[model samples]
Target chain A: MADFFNIIFSVDFGYAVLRVTTPILFAAMGALISDKAGVINIALEGMMLISALTGVIMSALSHSAGLGLLGAVIVGALVGMVLAYFALNLKTDVILAAIAINLIAMGGTVFVLFMVGGDKGISSSLASKVLPRIDIPLIRSIPVLGPILSGHNILTYLAFLSVWVMYIFIYRTPLGLRIRAVGENADAADSVGISVRKIQYTALILSGALAGFGGAYMSMGYVSWFSKNMTAGRGFIALAAEAMGGATPHGAMFTSLLFGMFDALSNSLQTLRVPAEFIQMIPYLATVIGLVIYAANKTEQIKRIQAHQNREARKGAQEVKLL
Target chain B: MFKQKRLFELVRTVLAVLIALIVALVTILFASDEPGRALSLFLFGPLDSLRHFGNVLEMMIPLLFTGLAVSIMFSAAQFNLGAEGAFFLGGITATSVAINQSLLPVVHPVLSILAGGLTGALFCGIPALLKVKWNASELVSSLMFNYVALFLGLYLINYYMRDVDAGAMVSFKLADTSKLIRIIPKTRVHFGLILAALTVVAGYYFMYRTRWGYRIRLTGLNSSFARYSGIQTASVIILSQVLGGFIAGSGGAIEILGMYRRFSWQSLPGYGWDGIIVAILARNNPALIPVGAFFLAYLRIGADLMARSSDVQSEVVYIIQGVMIVLIAAESFLAHYRHKLVYREARKTAASGK
Candidate 1:
């Protein structure tokens, strides 16, 4: 237990946590944006999966990181186009469509991976470029905290900055209001100038962009190569994080970070003599518990406040009678 | 009324098969370097080989069982995804039972099969119990339980059932009496195929004609309405899942007994996911399960052959499946199939909610 406590601050462990958190944050925020617009985005996992493969394939061919990243975005957008076409133009079930996307993406990635590498599940032989790391100048000189704060992969900083950017976009922008309005009541938004389909499509495209970046970062920043279906279940975990965070930017970030921490701990927990399967079960189990608590608390808290209000009103009534 | 419904069913089945065919043809063109003969070989190729035909049946039996499993449960509106885990564990349990109780009795295989069915049902029942008691979402809990089932199965196989003489993560060899007898020459088709078909028939009877099935279907159509009618919705949901688990568990048991000398499946077998597709294609109709299973079985067997022949990965079926599932979910095709029972009922299902 003492050794376990000491290792929590270790650099490798911290980095693992960051790595785990980064992919989920990217996907969750993407989900958050779409969901805020009232368009259910279950396709985030599918988006990550296909984009990851697209990033790998492009990087392999072009040997350029920018091209790979761009390639991933395009791939994401194409997938987004299909989703938008169905959810918007076709009037399909959004959740069902998302489930379909996830299924296809899962199968499609493995297929493509095997096609290129002639391997069953992964590709290691076709070496690809990863995202370049950035060195922030003065931040490295501060103290023990400096090492923790500075010298993260460029995507890490971008992931953190996305929260603030999204928060501003959600609260300060006219577009954000339109989206929220659309989410709140589609018919009302439609009665106004806002197009429900347009908002859903826009949110989906933006979602694809963020999820694509998540895919690129996983391949380039976290690891050197793409394995068959290597996104594991992080995309689903990201969705869970979004639900736990109550679909807010700050709430999502907090839960996303927590999920990432658990994910990292699971992988590293084996070193601490925990069973590998239990470690693997952590983040997923966390999702189930987190959702139950978050959902249950909403009802419980509302009841408490209502009870208090009733008590206050009764006291006022009694005072009036006495007077 | 019955004639119209039958015609609608016929049309839907044709459309589903045609969609799958088109996808297969497109895949073949992209896959083959020598497209002329290879394309023909991909489509008509499975029929030429007795071996491939046999392989198709072997594949069909497990999927048929799983498809029936899913269709039955989905009829009750309980989307228990735990069948995959149950099937895996059930296979292991059957293997373990067969290996240990070799000298017990003449009815050793029957007992082992029963053990498999019971364990699988119990594995699925845990999630159903949670859903009934805590108002927990079965989808989430069952998915979680899948992992538990997976790990536990691995543990059991590794620690107890493992055949030391075998190469990798597999189970011990079973007694000679436990090995299932093949029904067809040169095919792995055992009595399990008949068992699968019987289950589908039983499933159809349960879903369409029986009192308990009426309760399950009514509860599925609308829980509030079912409850108003004095149905025990919670128990029906749990019961359907248990039954579904039993069928899938027996499928796994048969898969172990008939297909190999020892238990060899090390990881997830993917029958459950395919079963999901089969259920959707059948539109959750129990009667269509056999057709759905056979269609899936053909695709899998044909793809396996294509991969082996051309060295192209069969994983490409996923892209095709993704496209297909995406299209299916879109359901704009319903406009064309407006005459169908399911499409009309689904429209009413949507309308009633609104």
Candidate 2:
């Protein structure tokens, strides 16, 4: 227990939490955007995988972090177009399509790795560029909070700002209303002359951008180099975040932060003398337990709803008979 | 008339196979492979020697069984991807049982295999229960559970089964009687092949020949209609998942027993995803599962051979898989294209009449 406390309060642990959550938060916001628009974006993981590859490759070629981020966004958009084509136009099974995209990305990325660097798993050299932190002079001087807030990679700020942007896009604007309408009732929105497919396509593209940005964070910001399958199921974790956050941007941010904290805690547990494998499995275990509990709660809600309906019907029948 | 439909079905299957081959050939060429050599190897590699041919058959057994498993569950309208998990756990269970054949000396090996089968079914049963009890999406739940089972299996092997004598990650060796004998010399083909075939045959009768099959199919096609038709759709759906889990579990046991001396798979065996493609390729026809598995096995064997003998990377086959499955999912496009072609021919005939 003392071991746990010492690790938890360590400066390194707090900073690691910020770093871990940054990519997950990016992916969660991306998921939130498309899910709000009625398309279930299961390819978030694939997008991140490819984007991470692209981010690293571009960084290697150009020696610029900005290009790495741009490369990731473009890669994300390309995959998004493929997904949108199948989902919005071809009218295939959405989840299955996502699965296909994932398979392709997995294989394609590995193939690219071998073709370029002559390795299956990772880049062999350490000369590739990585995103560096920037210090805001004013924020750094303020106190304890400034140190926490100021020294993140530039993309980290963009990730947080994206939450507010996504909130506005989902709730404030006319297009947001239309996207929400499409999600709630496609036929109703179609009747009102909203193009459900178009909205879905656009939302998916935006989602791809955000997901790609998340990948960029992984390759450039989180680590200085690329590794195979290094996103390591964070994309799926973002799916849990989307659900836990109530499918809203604000809610998703908090959930992502919470997951980030759990991830940080798990990472720290290593120093706290927990077994490495058990610590590694924490987020996935948390996902299963969290989902089961949430589902059970929803099922109970349905039962309560049915019971209330029965009571209301009984009351109405008795009143009519009395009248 | 009989020949016409038979010819059409043959043509359709042939067309699909040809398209896959052509795409593969074109990719090999684009990737700077010796097109002729790659093509020859891909086409004849599996049949080049008895060992490779046998290898294909051995690979086919698990694919056939797991395909039927997925087909059976899908025909019940539940997407439980837990067969992969079931297969993984089942392999470990089979290995464990085989390793301890001497300990349970009095018990029949038959009973031991049944225990292995039940262990696999139980692995899949968790997701089935989650779906039935919690209204959880089986797809998500099953996918999630695969990781849990994977990690747990890893932990089990690492902590308990890892042998100090073995240089790397592997389990304890099985007893002599525990290993499934290869019936053909130099061929990987074993009695498990027959078992796999029997499983498919049984699945056909289960889905199409039985009353219970009708209920499951009805529920799968339209649960609301089945419910209105007074069929217990929920129970049928849940039952089919259990049955599907059982077959997949058995397939895993068969694979481990037949292929390895120990349950040595440390990660996901790709049989489950291949099973999905097989199920799709069969169009969920239980009778067609063996054929689909054979085709897939042949392709896999061919790709490996092509990669070994040429410049083409083996991962290219995965891209093909993704493309093919996604294309298959667009069933409406195929139907629409066929409809248009038929209509055009009819118009030509009418104009000729005029």
Best by lDDT: 2
Residue-level lDDT tens digits of model 2 in B1-354: 346445544555556556756776677777744778877887799999999998899889899888998898888888888888888877777676777746543343444456656876776777778777887667766777777778877777878777769988888887667666678898879888888888889899989999998898999899899999999776887788888888887788788777877767867887887888899778788988988899889888988888888866777777777777776675454556556666777788799999
lDDT of 2 by residue, A1-323 (tens): 87888877776676777778899899998888888888888889899999998988888888888888899999898888889898767777888788888877877787777766667678666356777797989988876667777888878888888899988888899999998999899999999999988988988898899999999998888887778778877888888788777788888888888778888888779765555667776777776666677678879999999999999999999999999
- The most accurate candidate by DockQ is 2
In model 2, which regions exceed 4 Å deviation? A125-127, A136-150, A272-274, A302-323, B1-17, B101-112, B338-354
* Candidate 1 runs further than 4 Å off: A117-119, A299-323, B101-106, B129-136, B334-354
Model 1 Cα lDDT, one tens digit per residue, B218-261: 98889999999899898999899999899888888888877878
Docking outcome class, model 2: medium
Summed over model 1, clashes come to 0
- Model 1 chain A: which ten-residue window has the lowest total lDDT? A291-300
Could you estimate the TM-score for every candidate? Answer: 0.89, 0.92
TM-score of chain A of each: 0.91, 0.93
